[model samples]
Target: MTDEQQAVCEEVLAGPRSRLPAPLRAWLFRPELARRGQSLGAYARYGTCLAPHLSELAILVTARFWGSEYEWHAHKTEALKAGVPPAAIDAIEADAVPDLEDQQSRCVHDLVRELYASRTLSEESYRRGEAILGRDGMIDLVAIAGYYSFVAMTLNVFDIGVPEGAERPFGRGKARAEAL
Candidate 1:
């Protein structure tokens, strides 16, 4: 690794992710992408108007949407730690609608689901999302989903997996729509 890239990696991963994540490690091959993604991910995750729990929920939805097992493995624990309900996590894993009660969580989930499923929100969904999340929160909600979708693509295309003996949370399967 170039000294500069190594430094960028260290600064971004100063916590439990002692090493670059597998997806980020792959990005080191393209150092600029890694650098920019590190900063963008930080903002999307920590600086977003969405709270930590809501951000994690968006990540979980993206992970499941792409069937990105490594993303799911990494973020499921984080989502739970950040207070995403276990039932919601499980429902996401099973490709079911999570019975979310918090209006923010519900709105975030519906926004992601509607966008991902239809590639555009219905007028009703768009208005509801705008009302529930406001302008900034709504934007952050989509940003988090878009960022994690890229992460999921990296993991899936690279065939990345969690470390050996670690359970794969999302499992290997076609997306729900694909199965029909």
Candidate 2:
């Protein structure tokens, strides 16, 4: 790493994240982008107005959309810790709409899925998002999805894997039927 790259690393490590994530490590190849991406990442992951469980749900949706194994493995536990139902996570992993009774969770799931499937939100989707999340929360929700999408793609293109011994979220996992 160049001196500039090392400095970027120091900046990221010194921030709230405290450690470099895999995407940031790859982005460090261009220190400038690393600097900016991490800044956005910090805000998306930490500064969002949405609750942690909602944030984690958005991330999981993004990971599933991209088939990002590393992202899924990393955030699945976080979603649970944030109080997301395991059944919802399992449904997401299985590429099915989760039977989320929570209006907010369902709103987030639909917003993200709409973003990916149509590349834009419909009037009704936007209305529901705004109604449930409000303007600021809606913004934060989109930002979370957008940022994690970038992270997921980075993990996929670089072939980043989950830690050894971690069950792969897709076919290699123990049994989806049980989780579902």
Candidate 3:
């Protein structure tokens, strides 16, 4: 691992809540905790919330878009446990088009694709998304993406290595060495 990655790994394992500079630690922890709290809050308000609503396929796509091995590694099991079809999970990891046969699954594919590709929704995409998810669901979808994007960035920036005994999220091929 690179020096930077090693440092990140140490910090993450140590706990971002504890490792943050003393002055900022409290605020950072509050917001981090609240983000999770609010996710739960939103779920409570809506009968079926966050993970179930967003679906594993969408989460996997977001993981791949950010090249976040950690997120992918973590979520792969969640996806499986949540009953996400294996084929869909495999397609997302491979960065291939999802073979969803239903409108709901297709909607997720479209939303994730548009968000990752442009970071902005086109009018048509927005309308279709709204039709399926309604306004609140749409907002939640964006939140999920935004929240996970932050996660992916943190993992990448810190070069947080995958836990031992975990399967490699990026498949069996080793990443090409960076040229100096």
For this target, which candidate reaches the highest lDDT against the unseen true structure? 2
Better of 1 and 3 by TM-score: 1
Q: After superposition, how far is residue 52 of candidate 3 from its true place, in Å?
A: 0.9
lDDT of 2 by residue, 66-164 (tens): 998889998999999999999999999999999998999999999999999999999999998999999999999989988999998887776676766
For 112-135, candidate 3 gives per-residue lDDT tens digits of: 889989979999999998898888
Off by over 4 Å in 2: 171-180
How far is 99's C-alpha from truth in model 2 (Å)? 1.5
Candidate 1, run of 10 with poorest lDDT: 171-180
Clashes of 3: 0
lDDT of each: 0.83, 0.88, 0.64
Q: Which candidate is the best by TM-score?
A: 2
- Local accuracy of candidate 1 as per-residue lDDT tens digits, 12-92: 778434556667767877888988887778788778888889999999999989988888888999999999999999999
Could you give the candidate ranking by lDDT, starting with the highest? 2, 1, 3
- Candidate 3 regions with alpha-carbon error over 4 angstroms: 1-53, 171-180
Per-model TM-score, in order, reads 0.88, 0.91, 0.68
